[model samples]
Target: MKKYVYPSEISGTIAAPSSKSVMQRAIAASLLAEGESRITNPSFCDDSLAAMRVAEGLGAAVEKKSDSVIIRGGINPVTDTLNCGESGLCIRMFTPIAALTGKRMVLTGEGSLTSRPVSGIEGALGQLGVSVKSNNTLLPIEVSSILKGGTAAIDGSMSSQFLTGLLMALPLAEKDSVIKVDNLKSREYIDITIDVLKKFGIRVDNHGYNEFKIPGRQKYTSTDIAVEGDWSGAAFLLCAGAIAGSVSVTGLNSESCQPDRAVITALRKCGAGVTVEKNVIHVKSGSLRGFEFDATECPDLFPPLAALAFYCKGETVIWGAGRLKHKESDRGAAIISEFKKIGGTVKIDKDCMIIRGSSLTGGLTDSHGDHRMAMACAIAAMGSSDAVEIDHAECINKSYNEFYDDMIKLGAEIK
Candidate 1:
């Protein structure tokens, strides 16, 4: 699908979407809790749906409602194969959970996920006594043998997702486990995982982000919980408000542990009007100027940050380009290439992405099947000189299915 976004002044209020990160983790935890878990304000994005299907495949009964999900948790392997769709988190996090059943199963995914390397998963699970086989270190991973808890080590530079899987699955093992991690990134994501585990009555000891101790034979006690609003998704809306006009976003926890909350700092640094009160964040247009931000721990911010930078006065430097290679697309390259198509300047130098603020000429760009890329381009178009045409705009459904509608509600002229 293609979307045409014209320059417009947006003004209004909208509730932020539910966080898929939290929703998926909640689904995984519910599947292990052995009783009914009520998750309120759930996300129904494609990624969250994939996690729900995986939970059902593992023998959980999931009931979906308009605003919440009720899951009766238990793992019995109703299917021999689980399809995770295109969510990287679902495949990485559920592999260990699947191994807990000690039943031979294949964990696979579609689209970009199939090409992502799973060797880290194989190596990590092997150390715990689970037999893992993958397609040349890629997806379609086959796993057997129970996770017999023991000491294991993992290289965490690439992603913190596998560690999340280990942490979620380890407490159920017959023996206690120890995990020594090297070069862990996205530590905040680990914090989110631990927080969700606690809600499920699971415990894990963290040692300076390098090691984790898990006591075995722990049972997950189901409980009612509400999924937090996604800072990652809200960042784009906040950026939209920063560059165009006033926007007020509610449903966000001011104290969210999600790293993308750093968007608030970046916006303030760039001279955007920002006001925070309770769960509400209001951003309005200001004398925007380029600013520097370190995105090493919040790589997902790069796209929206780039959009915000496009309308600023000087130059914007965002650190952490190295983490963009393995996302839905080579996200850095996608941003640079697509932004250039719209008459914006962007370049990557080693580990940094630099953008020079200028008037966007407003032309055609492709989403490259990445949801963030699609949203970023759309947001950048909101202040452009002409209508910006985006290809594959449907990609937004991956994370924020209602993004375009929300923008429309905020007075953006889209066709």
Candidate 2:
């Protein structure tokens, strides 16, 4: 249980963490490339690591150098059981991908991931000729018989990540296929997947997130892949800069299609002075007034936005709290319990979280083994009466493994 007592203000040049989302996707792409891929500036986060293990289990040879990963694809099933740790993306995305291979593999997970439903996977994989079995759609999935490659209509309103895995894995099938989706949400995340697939020499005919055409027997051609920075994790640092002090976060692309890129709008609305140029976003503290934000499309931004709202005047209401129920933690409940430890007000009204921000009374805080919670608490401690103490602080490794080290570089006091 590491604790941190962050100072009132932080002023420094902080390099934004690498995008775990991009890194995980790249690993999957590399596995399909059937060649050596040079992935530079990769994330060692737990989710990314889980994706790596999945690729390795599929027979790809992966080697790490300095900060780059060299993956040579072409794998045979190494084990019948795979662990996704606590990565929702890895599980939702990989369940379909693992079915691409006929070998029977059981997908099991630990922690909060265990509670997430996997029954949808059984249905989706079944449509593609894979036999699926689950305990009421929960973890410990048993998938067998390689997909026959045909039309599969999937329900996408739940999570776009499941579709991403299917798109990536379907290319290797013996026959072309189409995925008809209904109520597809997070269209931006699908765009991110398509962009990454294009980099690896794969193509998907996207019909506005509702329909996708995947040409079978296509190959994933590898190239020099450099993953972009993470807007999700960067949201926290940018908000910290807006609330505590001036910060220059280098390596975020403003033109990115990441759903959480909407964080910039939240910052600007909260009265944070910001400048975005190319891959850099600079933020400085200013008069933080409470602002209402709609985070339905980019639900991951809830925690960071909540942290930003903690410094705003009056009450801050962020919509889309209902989308947070099945995340790494029950983020809705976790936010309320943890934020209250730092002396703030958090209430759940239907589908929104209202945080009344002022001067925070910092004390012991818990991360609840959630990556966002750990970073959000650290960010909230910026203007706290006392340095905030964080428990289960190591959870940041799930996304930004170097988060604590980077926070230290910005002059945080962690003990």
Candidate 3:
């Protein structure tokens, strides 16, 4: 769905998308829960759907509704191999949970996730005594083991999803264990994991980002869960509001531990008029000043941050460029390339991206098959000479399936 967005000022209110990061973890917890569990505001994106399907395969009776899902837990492995679709998080997170059953399971995915590195999994699971077979950790991941849980030390510099998997699966083992991680990035995601596990009656001795201790033979209890609004997706809408006009986004908790919630902080630093109430986040266009942000724990914020940087009066610097290498595209580079095509100046030096604000001429931009990139381009339309012509724009379905339609509701000139 190639569409164009005319230069437009947007105003009004829109609800934030359900956090797929939260939703997927909720689904996994619900599946591990022993009884019927209902999750409100479940995400319906591609990655969320992949997690739902995995829940179904694992013996949970998953009923999807317009706003929620009922998961009757106790998985019975309906299929030999489970397809994780295009979600890197799903494959990595669910693989260890699958190992808990001591069943031989094959893991595969589509597109970038299939091509994304999985070398992290082979060694991590191997340390946990799970037998794995793979083509140098490039998909067709086969694992079977009794999963005698013990101490497994991991290098977490690459991704946090694998650690998320170990944390999820370790509790079900017959013996208590410890997972020692070094140089863990995305530690905010680990906070979410621990939060989800707590609701399911699992406790871990969290030694910051370095070590996690899990008690064995613990069974998860089913409970009602409410997914928080996604800061990653909301960052795009918030950018739309700040670049276009006054737009209010509801459903974000100001107290969220999710690192991407720092979008509000970055917005404040960029000089956007922002307000925080009980459950809603509000932002409006204002003269933005150049600001610096360390996105090491929230690399997903890069795209929207780039969009916001385009409207600033001077140069904006964002850290954590190294973490963008394994995303759908080289995200840091993709943001630079796409934004620069539309009259923005972007440069990469070491582990930072410098975006210089200017009068952007948004004639044409491409999403590079990255959903965040797609929304970033759409948000950049607020500063376009005319409507931004976006190619491969439909990739927004990866997280926010109704993004353009939602934008239309909030007065974005998207057609």
lDDT of each: 0.96, 0.85, 0.88
TM-score of each: 0.99, 0.97, 0.98
lDDT string for model 2 (67-148, tens) is 8999998757788888998998898777777887788889989887888887667787788888998878898888889877
Is candidate 2 or 3 superior in TM-score?
3
- The 10 consecutive residues of candidate 1 with the worst lDDT sum are 110-119
Q: Name the TM-score of candidate 1.
A: 0.99
lDDT of 3: 0.88
Q: What's the TM for model 3?
A: 0.98
Can you tell me which runs of candidate 3 are displaced by over 4 Å?
Answer: none
Q: When superposed on Cα atoms, how far off is each prediction in RMSD?
A: 0.6, 1.4, 1.0
Deviation from native of the Cα of residue 51 in model 1, angstroms: 0.4
TM-score ranking, high to low = 1, 3, 2
2 versus 3: better lDDT goes to: 3
Candidate 1 segments whose C-alpha is farther than 4 A from its true place: none
